[model samples]
Target: MQTLQAQIQIPPEFVLISKVEYEELLNNTLDGKFLSLKEVAEHIGCSTAYLKNEILYHPRYKEEIEKWCHFPTSSGDHYRFHAKSLYQFLDRESVKLFLKKKY
Candidate 1:
């Protein structure tokens, strides 16, 4: 049996750190971080209105979206999304699209 290993070359401008340090930094950065609806919509490359109307309210993904988001006001006109959850959801959606195309 043989084992294979791969190495990734870090760019000149990038700093290399141990996994533990990276994890610590990530945790510190993400702790209690929440993004506004407009910020999230911009990050995902969609207009706020489109994000709210098409994906957030769409039947296929609304339930899942709600799990990671909250309406801060009684009117339900404002949304704040947990940073980690939003990233995870986007990653899952990306994988789903990839598999759909591959198959």
Candidate 2:
């Protein structure tokens, strides 16, 4: 058998994160009122794919789904959801039932 040794390299600039700071960073990162698809799924206690399939693509919810998203007409922008709108969509059937349509 042969013995081997390896060397590790560090960049010129590196900042160490403290436990408290790390926790704070995590909290801040996820604390926003608006969320992406992944964040919305996490909030609703479901997998992203499940949410996308079961709710996002459901025919009964099609018009409402489009209404709650952050981007409606932009071809290149990713979809985002306002926390309030998402909650309303789930909690209030009236919102979906009375679709006046949005421009």
Candidate 3:
């Protein structure tokens, strides 16, 4: 009996994400799935505090964020994110960045 081993190369930009995150992305491709603030933060790979401060509350992205997120209470402390819309928002931002760099 013989054993063989092979080596695989990963690209520099390739990211290694946990199984939970992978499943979250795979399973939440539809528009109706709602995610809590914490889950959105994790999916986007940012701290919850940073998500709230920079993206959620920032003036530049606030309007777009609001389109896909909801505040369930009058206090505006809790957020529920629409998974597909959130992903689309991120994709649009990335494309904007790419075009900015190309010009």
| Best model number under TM-score | 1
Winning model by lDDT: 1
Local distance difference test, per candidate? 0.77, 0.69, 0.76
Better of 1 and 2 by TM-score: 1
Instruction: List ranges where model 1 is wrong by over 4 Å.
Output: 1-20, 72-77, 95-103
CA RMSD per model (angstroms): 7.6, 12.2, 10.7
User: Which lDDT value does model 3 have at 90?
Assistant: 78
Error of 3 at 69 (Å): 0.7
**Higher-ranked by lDDT: 1 or 2:** 1
TM-score of every candidate relative to the true structure = 0.64, 0.50, 0.57
Q: What lDDT does candidate 2 reach at residue 37?
A: 85
Steric clash count of candidate 3:
0
